[model samples]
Target: MAMRVVDAAAAAIAALLGFVLALPFCLAAPSITTHGSDGGGGSYVSAVGDPGMRRDGLHVAWEAWNFCNEVGREAPGMGSPRGADCFDLENGVDENGQPTYKVVHRVTDADNNLRAGDPLPGSPANITDVDLYAAAKELYLGDRCQVPDSPSPWQFWMVMLKNGNLDTTAAICPENGRPARPFSQTSRFPCPGGAGCMNQPLVFHNRTALDATGRRLRGGLFGTYDLDAADLGSKEVSYYSVTWEKDLGSGGWVFHHKLRTAPKYPWLMLYLRSDATKGFSGGYHYDTRGMTKMVPESPNFKVRVTLEVKQGGGPNSQFYLMDMGSCWKNDGRPCDGDTATDVTRYSEMIINPETPSWCTRRRIEECPPWHTFRNGTRVHRTDAARFPYAAYHVYCSPGNARAAEQPTTYCDAYSNPQPQEILQLVPHPVWGEFGYPTAKGQGWIGDPRTWELDVGALSQALYFYQDPGTPPAKRKWSSLDVGTEIYVSKYAEAEWTLSGFDIVVPEDCVGSSQGGPLVPEFLILCDETLILEIPNQRVPISRGEEEQGKVTHTHEGCLEEVAAGEHLVGGRELAEIPDPAPDLGDAVAAGAQHDEHGGGDRLDHDGAAPALGAVDGEQREASERRAEEQHEHQRRLRGQQREEQLDHGCGGESVDPSNRWWARRRRRKWGRRDVGSGGISRRAIWGDGIRSSRSESSRRIHNGRLLEAVLGASSF
Candidate 1:
């Protein structure tokens, strides 16, 4: 009887949610047209600086990594395995009255060839460790590619390369961010010939220059994982390359990528990422730089891309047509570099036809508990007849999650420096509502199409875990990418081209209005004038006009009832704002409660209930301990500096090794699990009927930012 009641309530909420979202779907239907404006004025603006990669000037970079995301040792002569091709184009008329472009490359071979132990320009000559040198090199390249803009400066498109060979005997990778002890290798995790298996790749770069026509710009980066191989063109070695080109004044740049794997290095990954320009990007512990200037939050952004997959990497290839990544703690606070408590949340759509779904009716743990359809109707994984098992590839719970569903497989603990959660989906009819491929091979090899996906609507509907009674985490995605993970397979190769990549968000939803109500009114703000016109009032408000009035109106298309206190901005109706709160809380509550139940019922590797409680309490203690350590280190450093100055008279202050040790220690502490923030609760704007005083919003954000700054400074 209780189960029946829960089902009935869920059905009712789904219906209500469907009614609220129907009209919005109609208003912003997906279109292939590049321009959103009709020559008249419009509100839409591209969130990316180089939207569609159409700009004449190109900014692109590449970074290579060993098994643990660190550069354990530099390639023989290839520097730190970080290189870039950023250039500007100067246009002029030729003698034949045709257009001509002269390319100006910013990064030179000298900059790219600075090996690990080499001195960097404009910096003290003491920083020489391979991993630290690579981090510094990326920053150097970013400076050469930065484009200063309104909100924030932006960097180049990042081409990331990674190898999945782990030398377990090395004990290099931390165990879920803790100090790891060496162990014997397991078959599931590969380590072919153990020693030197985790070496960095050899790199090659083709600087961007004028094409034969002198009207096009082109460049590329290619290399191999087989460090000892003499010939890159030989067929027996693992290899990868990305060649990008753009017409002088035409459409987006096309990035063609090809990756091949050999028997020794069978598992590899390559991705073109639009990472955040500042702050920590997905899966990265340090501060970073990249293309996305304004991060896109969930349920309010759209992603567009043009992909053509010529070859799939055999059956093991997981080709992500679209992959989104974000970071947040289990208890709904943003990540502040605490690896133990911070979880990397990722969602990917594997378009490879060979990838089969591991999520089935009988394997509920491999699936998110429920699937929410377009019309708000949700079916649990146990509903064999109604659940679309074919739509999911697999769902892996976080390794540190104590409350994960039974039989759930934890993600690979060694891949990332921190615990991670992943949800991989495949093509199916159920995804059609979000403009995704509805069937297998819909956008594969021969069926390439320019996709304008309604990512926000779809992501909002998906199920991600959180503890019960905790405020929901704001899904502010920091990395939007497209690429492939060719799982262990010998002699397998994949080729693809990606273009017209972009992420778009509603103007009002970003920045200041992050926590504001979702107003349905057509808010036209021109020349300092803010016009809020209801749907009934189609009359256009002229620019530079100020007016304040109230009017009653009704839209028969919208059927959801507005709860009390949810008043329109101005009058009878502000333009029936899509139900400010779509009643989808029943689903969230049910999902979250299930997580708590799992925590109590499940056992950790050490046979105990994991430390899932006292989130804020423990985090506060961690923060204070971090602060005390910082003061102690600073005081000791000051005394040492004074002693050096007095003893040596005029010696330059040297960089401290203690500082680096402090960073590693902090990373280890973060690996120890500090879940939530210090009692910071701002009414999370979810469909649930939860509310909080507006007074706490500013204080909470301020403290979050302050703590983030403190943690960052303390580490560096």
Candidate 2:
């Protein structure tokens, strides 16, 4: 009798609210075309699955690491250090014509709570070892959260937490990728409590759900490295939290991050990363999965993000505005899961004003061998007056570089699975051309701003070592992130919010199995003024003016004409592209130009110049297309081979390709959509809700607000 009444009451409430449950689906399931070339002739495509992070349904995950970028041991009851939160939003109309929504989650608490000894669903067998289990679990979670898309399926954004305590006496980490024996405790590596100091954190998740307002989604992961602490709010306890929230109908998701350090865990690092969907990423030797649908290569990609630093972590905080990581051999080959041969390379821009530059003339070993200016000029560290010493914080060479210059500081040997190289930068006039901060405190704290960093150009200009006779390695970055590393600072706190994050690369550069251009034609609404804000410029389009025949826009002193019905957005015009730098041979000669300044002998191991140079236009284009085709073919073959080898159930049982799981993966691997002659309509470009009849005043107001939200008030 009581059950009947309760069921009747629930039905009544459901009917009153007009609540309708929709079938579970991923965000933007019916793929709309997203790749295009602007009218100004710059062709580009999003490198990430969720461009600008504007999708209402979100996909994100979390992972924790010890000092050496691995799961040392799991905390008390906290499973294998990997977890995910992925969900889709369902919309419905209420009885009063008001809107209603529901969050349909893809992953559950049971999946997240699986411990090291537990079996992974699609693994070859149950893994009992903690480190190997964590790596396998990450792959399992990635499968659960994977989103089907063109080119390939992608996983989630990674929120990575790392405890920097190192127990040298335990000898768990390798030295320069070689096995290390136990040693006495040293003050150099922080291990406040000795033996178990490198344990993983206690992670707690708040599954995403409709907030009290019913119009917003909210969720978070919060916990402490100091697992014994009873209260997270206490100053002595290390705590970290990353919470996400977004309104239902519009705007991008904002990730709120807070990290605090305690005495015992003084060196802690937290970052939000866009890692490669497959293969090794950054310092990890295991196969990793993440949001970067296409790994971005140096000299061809740009990173756009909106960051607001609310509280500076402190003087000891190494706040990286942008951090890029990749792995390659010193001999110019790609890494193939060999820890002994692979080397991780990292470049970061530290925005903390209090951080001092350590690459001064007095500390010559801390500086890179050479610095390249935006105008293609080169200067060696020995050319003290010409070299911008203040631009660099510190540069450490890889431990295994056979021909590394004398008086160089090798990077910390035990902090990564393999040898590593690091280039740390500080704000100075030298970096202004890359859209980086021109001075200290530009984007720190109260000066929060949206940064459109030309990471490709900057990285191309930066110096990275290669073997003397080898071809330069392709700088394909597998991980790009932003965060703070509170280095040996106790009771310190850092707070920030990140949004509108995106990685963009040239459309033609991205591989297409079909061997055809991936450009999409875009249509503009009849008389609407479309305003597009790209990296360094704003294009205001008034269709009425365009119909007068040709639309002309000036970019970098060059005039580009756009025909009617065509539009431009999201990329730089061709004329804005600077000439490619000289070949590595020429760069070596240029470096030698300053030989009289006592840097002559350092050029011996600089290697062949980077693969950057200009050639006759038509020939260069054709050659590049052919090279890309060959590379894509090889890449596909490798991918298929890997897939076949790893396709098995938990008990090492092979699963048929006809199974639903395999079918989904196969269906998602189709190439990009062929370009259509008719072009994409305005509705396709901006989605359906925008009204064509909105008043000019109203549209102007809306555009202003959007610019302010994305670029901050300074954009005006």
Candidate 3:
């Protein structure tokens, strides 16, 4: 038997904050079975008006890390483990009203090659050292790539390159936050041959400028670590490159990433991440610059992304669809500067359906203690009949977990600057509830897609250790990314393109049943995908997962439910919840037309303004009137939606664990129905389904503190 989890700890806080948790009446609403007007409904939040790759100009960079995340032996004269090529496009209006944009390159080679021992033009000599040198290098690059916008400032997207081989004999990385100690190792820690095998690479940057075609703005950075070896086989040596381009002033940026492994650097990894703007990102020990300024917490956010794989690195390339990294103490406290106690936590959805699950009914060590249901029930990992073993790739706990339940797998000690916990999932029926790819090869090489995932809700249900009496750690994620770690696979090369990516924390007030107060979310106020936010200010970060994460595919997995409701109120026959607005559209389908003047008032279409007040003349008055009117309108709509419920043959107020889960598990024997504006429909956040090895597929509900509002059970 598994330990039962009722609602998440965050629910209690949400309720006390004055948010109304509305329960349905005894009578159910009419069954929702209407096909959306666009002919097909889009993701509830994503349908808001997907910006869909609009040109924000090309901004790109690349960085490499050693075992301790430091630039060890900076690749001979390759300078620091940092370099960038960022540019913006300025559109010029032609006399005929045609638009022409020019690429503006801001960073120079002099900026990238500056070493720590050299004099920084504007700085004093005090902050000179290896660590400070890298820090200063980033700051200087930020100066060149910085793009100003309302709300907060931001920088270019980062292309991260990491070499996993660690020479433990060298004592380069710390152990469990303590100083690095001499530890005897074998094949576990990958080493090619020599002692200095752990070194940065020779990085080259092609500053952003118009490509020869002259029609598109393009730039890229490519490099290799086989410093002195020129006769390297495509797979015998290591190489990586990321070239970005966009039609001047037109589509969104397209970042094409290519990573290859060699005999020496077989465990190389690469990812595009949205990190914190001014705080620590995943696996990072210092304050950094990034795309996501505002970090996102679990169960309350959704991610929209598009991925197309050009080449699948060999079987060992563990690609991630969405890898979210965060930090906190084992005691459930916000992580501060203490590298020793602070743990780097990650939850990755691996898409390589071929990846085997290290977890199984007999392998409890590879799984979390219990799985939460959509109806808020819990299934212990021991529930052989119920637990979905294949969904999990692996589960590793933090090294610092004091009382980690007996059956647990501790994470790798050398892979991070601090102890870390990882939860890896793969694409399976168990995740179908979250709108993820259900079968293998659904979105691999030839099948590209735009995915809307309920990351917030699913993460809430996943288990993270907390001290006995400590308030559960607020799962405030700092990094959300998509990339690959080609674990020691020689000659493995993976190529993919990602664009139109976003993570949204709906604008709903903390808890109240209020609406229309939040500004529709955008790709970035900082003009980059990585966002580092100052808690509630919505600022994007550089290490950027908290607010912005990359969208990727593993060579692995996925991320969630609800509906037209009916009820019999006062015993009167109801058709549907009269005008009851679905608590959907948590910032999906955002676009350039969403009112840059105030960052409020989105305009998906002409009709969207009726639901969201306009930002034109008489804006204040119109907004006030609209607010009051909407309140009254929703009151009636709720009644109608309620009455409609009575007409539908579904109603049972006491809550049914099987029929619907609290956060996920909504089903329809019929087809789909429209839920939000702009062809949006009700979609699940994070959900799971269980299919016994080629057996019957049964949907298991996972309910956690993922969503801030009530989407009800019956979700994925």
Could you tell which candidate, 1 or 2, scores higher by TM-score?
A: 2
Error of 3 at 259 (Å): 1.3
- Order the numbered candidates by lDDT, best leading: 2, 1, 3
| CA lDDT for candidate 3 | 0.55
Candidate 2: give the clashing pairs. Answer: 584-609
- What is the C-alpha lDDT profile of model 2 across 1-716, one tens digit per residue? 32222232232222211211111100011121112212244556788999999998899999999999988789998888999999988888999998788899999999999988887887777899999999999999999999987566899999999999999988999999999898887777899987899999999999999878898889999999997999999999999999999988799999999999999999999999999888889888899999988777655578999999998899999999999998988876789888888999999999999999999998989998888775545677888899899999999999998877668999999999999999999999989978899899999999879998878667666777765544345567889999999999888999999999999876534434343322211111111223221221223322220012222232211123332122222221221111111121232232221111112232333432233233346855664565455554433433453232111101011111111221222122211122111111222112211322222221111211110011111111
By the lDDT metric, which is better: model 1 or model 2?
Answer: 2
Reference-based lDDT, each prediction: 0.61, 0.66, 0.55
On the 0 to 100 scale, the lDDT of residue 566 in model 2 is 26
Query: Could you tally the backbone clashes for each prediction?
Result: 3, 1, 129
**Model 2 spans with C-alpha error above 4 angstroms:** 1-43, 96-98, 511-716
**Candidate 1 lDDT over residue span 1-716, tens digit each:** 32222232233222322332222211111111111222332244456778888888988888888776778888787778788888888778989997777888888999899878787776677477888888888888888889986456788889999998898988988777666899998876677757888888888898988878787778998989997888777667999999998887787799999999887888899999998877767787667778887776555568999999999888999999999888877766678988888888889999999899999887778887667675545566788999899999999888787666566778877777788888889999999878898888988989888998867667656766665433346566778899999987878899999999988765433222222333222322111111123222211111101111111111111111112112322123222121111111112111212123112232122221111111135654663454455554434433443222111100001111111221222223232111111111122332211122323321111100121110111111
- The order by descending TM-score is 2, 1, 3
Model 1, C-alpha of 630: deviation from truth (Å): 24
Per-candidate TM-scores read 0.68, 0.69, 0.66
lDDT of 1 at 141: 83
Assess the local accuracy of residue 591 in candidate 1 as a C-alpha lDDT between 0 and 100: 21
Off-target runs (Cα >4 Å) in candidate 3 are 1-53, 92-100, 126-128, 231-233, 509-716
